[model samples]
Target: MHIRRLAAGLGAAALLLLTAPAAGGAPAVDPVTLDGPGQITDQVGALGSRKPDVEDALRRLDTEHGVQLFVAYVRNFAGRGAQDWADATATKNGLGQNDVLLAVATRDRQYAVSAATDSGFTEDQIREVNATAIEPALRQNDWAGAAIGGADGLGAVLAGDPVPAPAITPGPANPGGDGGAEQFTASDVIIPVVAVGGAGAAALYLFSSRRRKRKDTGGGEPAGWGGDGGAPPVTPLPELDDRAKQLLVETDDAIRTSQEELGFAAAQFGEATAAPFDQAVTSAKEELTRAFRLRQQLDDAYPEDDATRRAMLEEIVHRCTEANKRLDAESASFDQLRQMVTKAPEVLANAEAAAARLPERITAAETALTAMTGEYAESAVTAIAGHPAEARDRLQFATQHLGEARTALDAGDGNTAAVHVRAAEGAVDQAETLAGAVLRREGELREAAAKTAAAIRDTQADLADARGMVTGTRQDESTADLRGRIGRAESVLAEVGREVAAGRYDPLSVLRRVEEADAGLEEALTGAREREDGERRASALLDQALLTARSEVDAARDFITTHRGGIGTRARTRLHEAERHLDQAESLGATDPATALQHAQRADQLGEEARRLAEDDVSGYGGFGGPVPMGGGLNTGMLGGLILGGMLGGGGRRGGGFGGGFGGGFNPGSFGGAGTTGRMGGGGRF
Candidate 1:
């Protein structure tokens, strides 16, 4: 790290210290009062059965990394920024450096990740963790996952391992005028679909007119996804409005149906075979969450900004579009995996074929690992060290599942049979991939070593240039720093030389070390030439700028589209600003690339900022607003369809799903006929 970067880090700490006791604001909801330090205050009950998992993970983070993670879910941030509110909460709880607070405002759809000064993370790193690990999970309303991801990502930074990949960029601003949406008229596919009687399915849902009456802020004028988050259109466009509501119902119904199928699949085939489907469902749920949240905001009696409201509706439509797309994409794979229910013999036979090949693959992998170990250092092969063992384990797992499938076939339990066969197939396939990785890695490492050696030489030359510059009086204090940098680079080069000589070191590590050392030398050295792009013509720059601005805006839009449940107004506002700037830049066309570039740059900055703000909200949110109807019966009709978001009453009721719902839990089993077009109103969305 550079000296300037360190000072910035320290300054950040001081600022937080000075502002620890955040002042009160016009909070829409009261902040939860914490009793003490390191509290996992689940005021909103986000971490249901997974509380233990989060506790264990967080405990491990603190126990092993000397960092404390405190979490709180509240109604809203007391009318303050999520970060400020989090800081105040941490300070009020008497927390110090090495302490981080993940604060979430349930009703506000906002969150923040705040840490004390000495938490061993720069603001950038904090934001990175939030964006890469935490937000993706949080946006899905996987509250526990968000918390766990935070702990894992922070730990990875400390451990000097590669951090998780950055979250995917949000969909493009206009989302390419919506991708070619595949109309789904066929029964939504779930393997071994449970047959639910229509009357029984209807019996399960007691749509209390009163319960339905309350969440319907449209006063029964037709809302999107009826819930606490349901909202009516600002001005109805009959087709769009109908589509939005119908889509919400269909999407929600699809998610419910998919979840049921997933559970059954997981039970029979194990989680491995159903992993992809899980991701799709999870993604759809998050999208619906965003759609519902937007709907909720629209429904709120607050005075409206027409543009903002229109944007929200547009966003809702986009969200619904994406949710259905995800489900549709995975349908084929999901349906195929469920074939064991009807074709148990054939499925089992396929697994046996995979099972036979796996053993041979495992042996080859073991041989490859052994051969590589003799030629490379331990670090060089550390990545693939477990490949052989893992493959062997999966082979055994597959074999066991195969046996189970056969037994289920004998017992005439087709569903169970299908599950085991799918599990076997999945395990075998994974075993093959694991086995193959060993061979692939060996070649990759060999080539990387060669490339890395060349890079090392190039870096050595750069170090020498830096050393040459260190002798001048112009160096001043920087000269001393230059000497230190040269010394470090020299040491790295010498070590790499020895490794190259031995031909037995971690090539990846060597490459990274050399690169970092090179970067350090650059930072210490004086001036470099201006960026070449600056020399480009205004037209050229403007064209490039327009493209860049569009990309950033698109990404921000995609992120907001999916993760709307946890994001707040600032993110949406930021994205809107980005869009305006983008439009301005595009309006310039070729006439003013230079001027357009400026607007484009602003758009890019705001677009990224919008994403950052959204990530912050996701990381901070601890509430799972997906309503799980409890006793009293589900009033799931946003306008007419079943309400998936059991969240009816807003503001105070953050613990709707896990703690309890308006009605008793709306059993997915009760909605079983919903698995197909067999029941649950007509064939609209499902």
Candidate 2:
């Protein structure tokens, strides 16, 4: 298809070339010649030239697009020899491609354009120009256009003298003859052409002029010059120029006002006055108003000079900066005041400390009463230690509860002061339990460290043993014993490392196997080495063991820490219990303000109980009847049930009668009666 279309176009162009007229005859007049820089000379020469190129171009137009065009000039005229002398003149004068053409003849101007017949520059083009430009131009004696316009062949009629009609000499009519040959005069064409052209040009000029005058007189910027489409940047408004400058001055005034207000506020703040903030806020507000006004002025200016605008913008920034500084200072002062209130609890603690340590009346009174419940006992200790000012009375009450419990225990009244003592003990138990967790964590950590040291020793032993085995075994040895042992041990260790990373950290099981492997290798190597090098080899092996042990400890510590924070069953259950019990305790403890000790103790008891229970059960406990044991975080699907003993139990009870592992650690109902040390409500009558 593409080839077919191309061939068709080529054929049409060829047909055009074939149809062009021969250019063998000499021109009727020497073709007007232009040699230099004006297009007029070339234009005239182009029209007047007998050159085959020009004639061929015209013939091509005629054959292709069906247009006959003619050029007109006075006889014996000569000017220049180039193609477009007028265009050459404009080019030499440093004008642009789109600037006015330089062709002139008499008083009127002219233009020239080149066209292909495909462009439809035709005889109709001439008729239209005669109507549009030629007749009018001639009546106005537009000689320049008459000459250049005609030479350019751009649809223009040349001026010609009107000829008077000859007297009619009617010859005797032959059988087939027409009456006569009609003679056309120029007047018949020129009058209507001139009238229509003049009226159209006048109406256009009048309408455009009136609209422009209206826009100017009505105080609008001229639309034609530059509308909102960004023809060029327009000047700023004159009315707002002074307003913009005044805005800067006013902003200075606002700054002064704010400064004055700040000074007043600062003086008040120094005097420990509460009203300073309000005054400072008011001043800041005024400054903000001034800033907004200044911004408005800037906006009204529309566009401004760079220097003045920069100065204005800078002044606005300065005002804002100053206002913010004042606000910051005020905020700092307010924060200091707020800190006094926020630190009340700490201050109260200090006050209680001073009172308790002194041989003061409050401490003496507190000492007079006590309670004997483990809960009360523990609370007594915490109160004694903390000596929180707000809690001093509560502590005194706790001491009383302790005294009561001790009396009941002595008198064999097991229930006496039991609830209070237990409540108090729960508080103490929490601290102790927390301390236990820390200790257990530390012990676990140490045990882990030891395990890691042992593992490292094993790896080093294995590595060393591998070295020894490989050392003794020739590279060509086919024995599977040495490489098989080393490869198996390395694989096991790598598996252990992955388990540790994945939070299935089974230190006991993994370490036991590792220890067995190391022992077997050490024993095997010991006899061989001793036989080979006596004690010297032992010393080197021992040194390597020491380094291996250290590295193992370090690696294990890092492994535990990296995996410790991950979601584990025990940690998740504990965290959930903490959140739940804290929320519950906070809700329940707010009642009975005078019995604040009882309420707060109950709340604390509940929370600590929840936490201890969560850890001790190691089995899942339902939170507000939600699903049991939110499984150990990420790897819960696998090891979660094993660690937390599955979520099958209800009522916070340990699951399934396990003996020593998880559920055996705590029995809350029995715990309440057993006088458990560090437990809430233990050894107390509830």
Candidate 3:
């Protein structure tokens, strides 16, 4: 049994789907339509405990008033587009069983509204729905909302008793004329209709009729759609119904025909004759675009507030559709003419007008799109300049041609104007490419200048640094070179000191011997300086002494040629042996002739060298000073010098009261025993 029932339900659904009429279908018959003055329909359903008045009203509308009533429960709003919503909307509206939905001429010149009813609605309730919801939705350009809200609000109104005063608000102001004084009325489509039960319906009928009469007689006030009263007068747009859109399309076609004729005439004028026809054509084309744009503006602006704006937009959409059709036809004609040289002037003129038309429209669209999308609108340049270089060139050429057109226009040469406008479009196309190239060049120049400036600064700094170095104003290469040399010399000195500390050699002994030689040379040189009269003789003696000193130094150099070798010179060896004997004799406090002789000879050699260098050498700056021996806690020198000769006779040995004091235990001068003859055990005295 359940399976059978399910199948029956499915069959019923299929039947309904096939039979249901489209939402915009023909006007419904009596009882299904909400029309006429003072006539109303009651829409209500049976509750658990149904009200008698509600049920009776439903029955009366269905039977006496020919109203149809129904009840529908839907799961979601998706059902709004379905037959369910249509039936539900009707059920919520009351209509006579035989009454039809309102029938207003589809091709009327004013706005019209109609509805169907499966559920009937009261007259007052329908008014309330139109005011509170339907009207507002329409004004705001919310068509779908207007439809759904009209249904919903109607339902709410019909579910209750009629109030003395309905809760409906007034409609928004009419931008085209005086607010409440303006009215839209029906025309001469006479169908005897039963009125609804309200003053509201009566008012609607009266207003509709008056508007229709005004339209027939062409007596309606000349007012633009905008509220600005001083605006140019505009003919009333066709009635906003389904067929209104078709009317707009027809109008668009008419406009294009007019433009084409004008353009042909314009071309003829350019043949070295009167150019009036060409002027007329250009003017006509411009006027056509202007008229189309104006219509769009009206459609967009009417219904001054949210209450009527939606209807206005819908009307505008129709206008746009019509305008687009005309545009397409004109464009196609232009394409055809473009292929023919005779019609080329007209084609070119049309293209120019089109180019001009797009800017304002695109701008307006961008603003609208921005508001709608909540993002930055595309730049005007981008929107108009199609793609790559082609877009740029087109725009550039167009602009240039426009300038030429303007010049021709100013000069009253319409033939030339047409030609120039064509050229301008081509110029417009090249603009983008030219602009890009210019920008690239500018960027490169700026970058090069920056690099040049930086390089200049760097060079200047380097020059300044070089100059500073020359004068020691800055620590430069020259200064650094001198510092490095000084630092190296100090390092060498330090290294030598360190070697002495580490016992690398008998440093003290070596130093003493070097000091003794240096001292004798100084003394001899000083004596040579004192004798001016015998300078030559003194210089000769000094020269002999210098040779002996040099010989001795040479002998020393040969004996101690290297640290790793034994003394190699015989003179150095014999002298060194004699010094040792003298040293032993000195330990016994005895003076030896042999040791004394060796010491004297060594001392004499060094002293003579000093004399020669100081007196005989002409390069000597002045006199030389002799060495001053320092005393210590040891015995004095025991080996006396062979002779002393400070104030004594020159060139001869002179005796002294103790010619030499005891030579000390260690004396640098005793390295070569001075005239020493004593052996250790055979010393004369101790």
Best by lDDT: 1
- Give the alpha carbon lDDT tens digit for every residue of 89-188 in model 3: 3333422111222211111111112332111333445555456644554444332333344334433544453322222332222211221222322321
* Better lDDT candidate (1, 2): 1
Residue 645 of model 3, lDDT score = 5
* Candidates in order: C-alpha RMSD to true structure: 28.4, 44.3, 57.3
* Cα deviation of 374, candidate 2, in Å: 36
Cα lDDT of candidate 2 equals 0.35
Off by over 4 Å in 3: 1-12, 16-303, 330-333, 340-686
Q: Show the lowest summed lDDT stretch of 10 residues, model 2.
A: 677-686
lDDT string for model 1 (12-101, tens) is 544543333232222254545674544588765667677797888789887666566777766567677676677656545544334577
- Give the per-residue Cα lDDT of candidate 1 at 51: 78
What TM-score, over all chains together, does every model reach? 0.34, 0.20, 0.15
Ranking, lDDT, top scorer first = 1, 2, 3
lDDT of 3 at 621: 16
